[model samples]
Target: MSGRKAQAARNDELILQAARAVFTADPGAPIAAVAERAGVGISALYRRYPSKEALLQKLCGDGLKLYIEVTERALAEEGDPWEAFAGYLRGIVDADTNSLTIKLAGTFQPTEELGHYAMRASALATEIHRRTVEAGVLRPDLTTADIALLLEQIASIRVGDERRISELRHRHLALMMDALRLPPARRELPGPAVTDEELSSRWWTGS
Candidate 1:
């Protein structure tokens, strides 16, 4: 590649890295914040992303891609099924705490392109859920949809101002592992688990 082209590529990656950090802290952070973190002027970023939503959309896509890769690794890992399941939860919680894009995934309205991505990610998760359930480690009644809501709840916790969010999230994940273990039989849950219909209704429309 030409020197100028390579430099441009480097700048783009830097902007993306900055966007990930800035977005994680505040999804609504202005484009200028990303520019500041990237050490580039706002014009430089605008030349690449055009708009805040456009930039965030790209970041979200990248986040989902990373999530799939990590999740697949967790599933493929060599270990006891229960351990694997717990590890999957831990991995996702850890990723969620870092990737601001994944943290805000629930807010994304699945447009045509992103909807397919969501489905792909969901499918991989379902496979992981299948393996975990097949091991009889998870509560049989727990649906794949439940994982989204559960992790989201964990992601929202703020244990303390000074505490690490990943540490807090992982702590909750440990608690979740204990609760997720299958009983001798399906014990009655307090309420209905999240339904697929309900989940599909959550598409973000950029409102």
Candidate 2:
């Protein structure tokens, strides 16, 4: 990367760190305050982000990448297919409910870049589903689409309290997984389809 691009990346990182600190301290804090904390001019922040929603989207995407990394590692380490699936599910839920993640999920819009990231994540999720199904750990009827939908729903839940979010996610995930254990006879459910509108509405409430 060129010097300017590197500097821009550094600035973006600094701004993200500052935004997390300010938002964690006060979710309703002003963007100007974030810029102040980041030691950048408000104009500079705007030039980089264009809108608060854009900033939040970038932050959320970054958080999701981290989540994916952990999930991938767990899947590799855990020898049992079911255990790997469970680990991935829990990792995703934990990442989604993280304070920074939650704040971004509540505020960000689904941009093109975000959509690409989602697609990549969905592909990985599908692979996990396929592996589990082949191992007879997941119901043969359970499709990767279904798993993705369940994950999206879990990710969209917005409990402001971190502990409450974590507990609720765990409870829901357990219940959902139990339901996925189907009888041998009924083993072919269709995958759930996700629409752009549905995803955009879930995270971005803005008009």
Candidate 3:
């Protein structure tokens, strides 16, 4: 690449990094805010991404792809079913590493490349669920759909203060994991589990 082209690429990277951080915190953040964070002019951002949706598509795409890779790698690691399942839950909930994954999951519709990635990710998740069931970590009645809903529920836990986000998320996730195990190990989940209609209405699209 020419020097100018390389420089432009570097600037784009900086802008994207800023946008991801901003949008993960507030999905409705303006492009000007991202430009300010990137220390670049708004025009520079538009020249590359054209619109906010364009920039968001990039962040969402990269985040979702990384999510797939992480899940696949975690499944491959040697561990007991409980360890593997717990680690994968922690990984998906690690907003530091995949801020946009959970943030964008609601609004994320599968495009061509991302559609393929989603398929692979779902397959891996199914395999993980199978292993968990065979090992008797998760209850036999739990479905893959149930697992997906549980993760989404974990993401939707509203922290009263930003400082408490990690602490609260980890605590809630541990509680949920315990409830996923078979009885007499499993404690009774308060209220009913999330149903299909509710998940589709709330989480299948942006809140």
Candidate 4:
């Protein structure tokens, strides 16, 4: 790409990173806050996003894209199903996608494009869960929704800097993974598994 295009791309990435950090911390923050965090001129930010809602949509869309990539990669793996499942959970934790979900749900109206990405990501995740269960490793009663909520619960932990946060998340997630792999006769999770409808309703569109 040309110099101008490369610069524009870099600016876009910076704006996105700033927006994620800003809005994830405070969904009600003003658009100017993102520009300040990004160290970009407000005019330049508006030239790209135009509105805070627009930037929010992009952040959510990018998050769903990352989820899709992670799940799809896990689905394509040829190793043991349990290992694939564990790696998938680890990927989601490392990506920190659930933090965005925890902070941004219902904050912006979902567009059709975002809906498509969400569906694709959900389907891929469900397939991974199905394979793991069929292999008799994952708990039969656990649903994909449970895993999503579990990961989101982990993301809510904020003790220190990014490195410490990651260490804690992975540490806790490993314990949860072991629980998920326990013999069904020996352990049963309480409460009903969250349905996809319930999960989607957390968003503004309720789709």
Candidate 5:
């Protein structure tokens, strides 16, 4: 890419980051405030995002990408199925609470990019579910669909206070993990475990 284009992309990212911070502070804040926080001319902001909804959509997409990256890293570094599951759940809740992405995800109509990111996130959760189940750590009766629904429900939470939200998120994830424990007879499934690649392909590419 040309230097000008690269610079424009950088500026756009900065603006989105600023907008995220503002939204996290107050989801109902004004577009003018976001532009001001971004340190960009209002006209320039409009030129890039066109409207408040568009700017919010961009923020959601960017934030989802960041969340996915963190989850992937956590999964890669951990060995224990329980630890990996906890890390993934905690990451999602923390990301939703702090990232502007979750703030705007439900409020605005999503673009294709946002939808794709959501699919990938859901797939990751499914893979986590499959892993825990296969490892005899979770109930064999739990399907990937159930895990996806739980993740969606968790992501939908909206708390006005950041501290309270953080605490609640932690408690909720812990409870969810604890509830995954299975009895002796329901320890394992007959089928193969779900791989990350399989889950990603099934949900994201639909192949």
Candidate 6:
């Protein structure tokens, strides 16, 4: 690629990274805040994203795409079904995709493109849950929808620094993983499992 084109690509990534940190912290943050966070001129950000909603759409689109890719990779991985399931959770937690869900929920309109990606990701996750349960490692009553909420619960935690946050997330995740695993002496969970319908309802427009 040409030098200018390459530089533009780098700048775009920087802006997107900044947008993730900014909007994921405060979805109400202005577009200019992203430019400032990215150390890019406001005019340049405008030239690329046009508006705050446009930037948000890009962030969600990119995040959804990354999530689908991670799920597909986890499914393709060789070894124990339990390992794949655990690895998948670890991957998404490290990706911190749920931060976008927590911070950007109801912040923007749902597009058909984003909806398609979400559906695909959900299907892939369901397949992983099925395989893990069939392997007798996961609790049978835990639904695929529960995985989403579980990850969200883990992602809700925040600590001193990025390194500390990651450590805490992984630590909590390991504990949660133990709880999720099937055990001989455990009693049945009392509540009804989360439904896919409820998961779908989170998207305001039914996308």
lDDT of 4 by residue, 1-207 (tens): 999999999999999999999998999999999999999999999999989989999999998999899989988889888888878998999889999999999988999999999999988988999899998999899998999999999899675558767777777777788789945323333334435654565465535
What are the lDDT figures for the candidates, one per model?
A: 0.74, 0.70, 0.75, 0.86, 0.69, 0.86
| Candidate 1 clashes between residue pairs 3 or more apart in a chain or in different chains | 109-203, 109-204
Which residues of candidate 1, in runs, are more than 4 Å off? 1-6, 97-111, 159-163, 183-207
Per-residue lDDT, model 1, residue 109, is 54
Q: Residue 92 in candidate 2 has what lDDT?
A: 73
lDDT, candidate 5, 1-207, per-residue tens: 899999788878778878887886678888889889878889878889898888778777766787677667666856887677667767767766334533554777888888899888667666667777788877888787776567666655434346644665565655566677653323333223334654355345435
Please state every model's RMSD to the true fold in angstroms: 9.5, 10.2, 7.8, 9.2, 13.0, 9.5
For model 3, state the Cα shift of residue 98 in Å. 8.4
Predicted candidate 2 versus true structure: per-residue lDDT over 1-90, tens digit per residue? 999999888888889988877875676788888899999889989989887777777776787577668657765865877777778788
Shift in Å, residue 152, candidate 5: 5.4
What would the per-residue lDDT of candidate 3 be over residues 87-182, giving only the tens digit for each residue?
888888874434555676566444687677668878888988898889876789989888777777777654444545565667777778887875
Candidate 1 weakest lDDT stretch, 10 residues: 185-194
Q: Could you give the candidate ranking by TM-score, starting with the highest?
A: 4, 6, 1, 3, 5, 2
lDDT of candidate 2 vs native? 0.70
Q: Give the TM-score of candidate 6.
A: 0.87
